[model samples]
Target chain A: MRNLFFFIYRFRAFLIFLSLEVLCVFMLVRYNTYQGAAIFNSATTYVGYVLEFQSSVKDYFRLASINNTLATENAALRAELMKYKDIEQTDSLNKMTDSLYVVTDSAKALPYILHAARVINNSIRRTNNYLTLSVGSEAGVRPEMGVITPGGIVGRVKTVGKRYSTVTSILHSQMLVSAKIKRDNTSGTIRWTGGDYRTALLDFVPLHIKPAIGDTVVTSGYSTVFPEGVMIGTISSVEREPDKSFYTIEVKLAVDFAQLSYVYVVEDPHREEREKLERDAGIKSDEP
Target chain B: MNRKFGFINIVQFVLFVSFQILFMDSLILYSTAFCFIYVGFLLFLPLGISRVWILLLGFITGFTVDVFYDTMGIHAAASVLLTYLRPHILNLLTPRDGYDTSDTATIYAMGWRWFLAYAVILILMHHAAVFFLEVISFRDVWYTLLKIVTSTIYTCLVMVIIQLLFFSGKRANR
Candidate 1:
């Protein structure tokens, strides 16, 4: 600071002259009738002309904090939405609670528990495609729980880790779900030949059912893998082989695999007990 | 011991400021040329006054004229600039015999030729700064320049006449 004073003193006359000149310039612009407006107009345009400048400035500075807060809120909202969504998608028939009827059926209206998770990694190009999720063992997501999007069925939980989980997406060649035609209750197995994301193959529907285009196919609830009435898609096209009695079904998939963002893990807490009882009773059904 | 020179300097500073603001400000010629005899105060400052004091005195004198003329800092800025340039002008006009600090810068003391050159240069630079700042644009630079030159000569003429009337015989010749 002392050095600054010395340096200033050395050039004091010129510095003083320069300062006075600057002061004069400022006053001239500030008070001059003609130039004042011109100067301010130019200055405002040069500095303030950027559209959304106020929001950009505020957003730029607080973006990180805002992002973190929004992320947390979104997580909470998604979890709540997924819970309600699980209730919305599950068959109202299966969730029935009537005290008048004695409990006699094994599939007795088991409540579905839902946990929201985001797709961390996914593949639709492979013959055997798998979807990775953000939730893992820490989120109570285990192997074999069904994962689904808001549109329709996604896949079953294949594996679980502390930080993430993988779902076998329905687009995989090996993935097959027991699905039924809502129009006639004709049950069939839905599969993917593994090329397109929009269509899946529905096999084993008998020719007598006469399924039409745009008929919604839903889960048959024949297996414990998925609950009844979860939408798979609609029948897009039907073809018949010259020798076969079954219809070759092409289903327009409801869930767009290419644009998948979030999925929910559907949990039935009584699934293990019911499967154990079924095994003990030797009531084995086609497991696929 | 030279109370006479100090008293004349004060009188010159006050009278030059008042006369320039009162009579000269309204004396605008050609909508561009303006009389700016306030520069005469800076011109009459004692030779070899430290550049800092010269600049300060210049700013004060011009600021005084600015208050009356309502030109804000225009006169002050020009005055300060001319004040800093004074030493170079004096050095350029210095005779081969060198300058006598005690002699002062009146025409009688320094000779009419040296005094005119010194005063004219300072007045020209001051007028140039003042008018250019007042207009604050270069759109009519040639016209502004004409005003600067004309005002410079008019200021020099007034200063020289003042010098003749104020300084003569014994004191300047001493």
Candidate 2:
């Protein structure tokens, strides 16, 4: 007993260190799996509601721009109505209404993102930055949806509440967005360099991809977090090494985070069904 | 007597943890605030406190910061290590029996040189461990090393500033 106590006392610090590290590793491993993912879902929804309430006050200022966008969309809709009438005058009225209703309902079924949120709690200064949006689950905000401003991609939903949701911004070091260059078919990953909020680094593009400065970068839609063809940023600079395999590209962000007042969260109504099918097919969704 | 200090220390721990998670954490300016306050905790440890309590305090301090940051157990691991090493540091600076029982470890009790030496070593160790674990999450060895050095420098500077601001006063001799 004396020898055992002596041995333990001599290495107590080491034992504590080992035990704590092991505990942390265990927690980290557990958190990375699906079991813990659902645990955050409820808390996220409650927090989202609170965040949305806080943001509504700031979002009032962006009403003019949002109104103008809605007005423009209305005018475009009217023009399309006229074009449809001219193209299909001989169709039966009942059939026309049914078809038109189906198309509109189907568009709505695509999960029309309705709420515009203002960022009240923003964190562009961290290695893993999270943005708080003022819209919540009560306003139809859900987890795994995409949030973007007219400027560009903001981030995807991490947690949702009745009135607010938290977004993991693209500026985070852990955030990875599937992006492709406009001029070429080649694609790569976009990740932040852990310092600048207005720029990101593109990785994995091959030397043969032929990228240049001013090339537009857009979402590749390889992941469900965002739809295909959404603008991400533009390549501001490119550094090609004499003996390297990939070009180091610097991208200028499209969103003016400093001036940001409002944003739209995109919701895919078919997300659950699509996810189920994908999982059944042994495919995993790339989420950050 | 120790129990009374323990209650005050718990309050301090909670305050620092809350400030780190809810306020400074929101600023997102590199999460430097937590790193700053962590040094402050080390500085505030009363002279003659048991070695086990020091390590335990360090563990709690680090674990609190980690829970909010969502980095799992990295802070806790580093903090426990810091606590484990604190006694060795205290021994180097002041003989075990030389320090006043009621006197706090302040810049006034130990000269600026000893205080700075102790603070720098502990802060660097904490920062190095944190950055290494965080960077290694993705398996980038060289990148992690660069982060360790740079972040350690930043954390060390902030720790020094915090020490200068809060713990510089001399306590009455016991």
Cα lDDT tens digits, model 1, A1-288, are 999999998887778778777876776555432321112211123212221233244346656755665576589889999998898788476557763555676456557888987664554643345665667677888777888765689998765656556567887655789999988899999988744678999999998888999999999977777788999999999998989989999999998776655578998788888789888999956544
Docking class of 2: acceptable
Kindly list the per-residue Cα lDDT of model 2 for residues B1-174, writing each as its tens digit.
121356656666766665555555433334343344555665566766766667777777776665445455667778877877787887887745677555565566666787778877887787777776665466656655665666666666665666577654653233
B-chain TM-score, every candidate? Answer: 0.89, 0.77
| Fnat across every predicted model, in order | 0.49, 0.32
Off by over 4 Å in 1: A1-6, A33-288, B1-5, B26-33
Superposed Cα deviation of residue B138, candidate 1 (Å): 0.8
**Estimated TM-score for each candidate:** 0.42, 0.75
Report per-prediction Cα RMSD to one decimal: 30.7, 5.5
lDDT, candidate 2, at A193: 78
User: Which candidate ranks first by lDDT, i.e. highest?
Assistant: 1
Highest-DockQ candidate:
2
